[model samples]
Target chain A: MKIPILRLERILLVSIQVDLTDNDAMQFQSDLVEQVAEIEALGVAIDITALDVVDSYMARVINDTASMVRLLGAESVICGVQPFVALTLVEMGRDLLGADCAFNLGQGLEILRTRIATRGDTRLSEDENV
Target chain B: MRMSELPPAQIPLHETADVVTARRAARELCEQLGFGKADQTRLATAVSELTRNVIQYANHGECVIENRSTATHRCIWVQVRDQGAGIANLEQALTDGYSTSGGLGAGLPGTRRLVDQFHIESTPQGTCITIVLTKPL
Candidate 1:
């Protein structure tokens, strides 16, 4: 298989823009295990919105991405996974506890917003005291 | 091999959880026919890939599963048929990485990988893919 070329950029001071689902086979490919480092923390978004079911390969990639981000001290959040894909994951018994994922765009943004805001709050309190 | 007509086993709908439903039926049948688990999964994956395509692409389809004990090996046969848009160039379509859609196009080739023998026939009316997996010597 040809390498899955990726485009990454900074967005909103948090979360990198990595468009994984646009063309070609539409999956992030089975090679994402090796490519997880590139998207760690403010990690790349894997769009599972179009897939009706999250197959075994996909579940592995997503899990791997999430774990990589956490290891790098950054949180990974998945966005736009459809309900059926979620169901399939549950049925197939994939655990995403070490990572974070959202069913919709709003939820993903909320995860980012919460993390960024919490960090900002900590910094603000430190400044006020010192 | 000459085409010898064999009785077709008509399975029920409770089995077709998706396109791969026939594979499950194949496993059950394989077990009953004394085929090993590993051998059963191989045949099941093959049948599943074909049956799934039939269900996903065709309005309706049926799985004809056959098991025959031979002198050399215990052989399993499966044919999944669907009355849908037949592939224009079936050979090319069966080629790896040649998808007409967002799918990875691994069904037919993957099916072939799982089985010892494979055959495909398609027309404007529909498609019929046959696969056979055999036990070890």
Candidate 2:
């Protein structure tokens, strides 16, 4: 239930939470993710660097988080991907192709900023239309 | 054998991810040692394939990695050895898509394509396959 978190910037952070425990057949822990949904504003970048991976639940969580964030009106991103971690995610065959991603933390935040800036321009236009 | 004479790592296969961990460890080492991104990718891919082979064929084994270089040419050798059944036909095993076991079938052969040199030796104790990645400057 306790997820290790690193606050990168205000309203944006990284959490090293278990996607799944070793005893469970599931590769990731859904219970922890549900806990993360409780926090307000910004987005949580789950640190998957420690996990070896199996099955697609975590991938589904990743997929769901993207939509989940949009519904919450918060920007989201995934970070800390090592080579094998990425490979296993791909091999598991999930619909992660559209997930906003970064090779590491630094890049992930940068991407989220870029997309958010683009949305800012759109918001300005919507205000003018209104 | 001296350090130079020893080949690439042959990691022990305790888990399915043993090879992946070892290979990633090596690639990290290379990055820490100051190799570029492309070099790390090639070496890591080669090691990953071999480790996957150990799991499929022997179920468990160890990885032995060697870093050997001379002047303009640097070669890293990795071998994934396992104490399981010896390969019956080395040539057939090397052939693309000819896996006796149902894996990607590309692990052994695909690893070969990723590196500069590749060799496999099988005995009752286990199989010692060496993959060499040479960077010529």
Query: What is the Cα-based lDDT of residue A125 in candidate 2?
Result: 22
Candidate 1 Cα misplacement greater than 4 A, ranges = A1-130, B1-8, B12-20
Q: lDDT of all the models against the reference?
A: 0.55, 0.58
- Each prediction's DockQ? 0.05, 0.07
* Model 2 chain B: ten consecutive residues of lowest lDDT: B1-10
Per-residue lDDT tens digits for candidate 1, residues B1-137, read 11123444565322235433455567777777677655665565556556656655775778888766566666777777878899888888777756565454555665566567888889999888878777753
**Docking class of predicted structure 2:** incorrect
- Superposed Cα deviation of residue B10, candidate 2 (Å): 7.3
Best by lDDT: 2
lDDT of 2 by residue, B90-112 (tens): 88877765656544355456556
- Relative to the unseen true structure, what is the C-alpha lDDT of residue B120 in candidate 2, on a scale of 0 to 100? 83
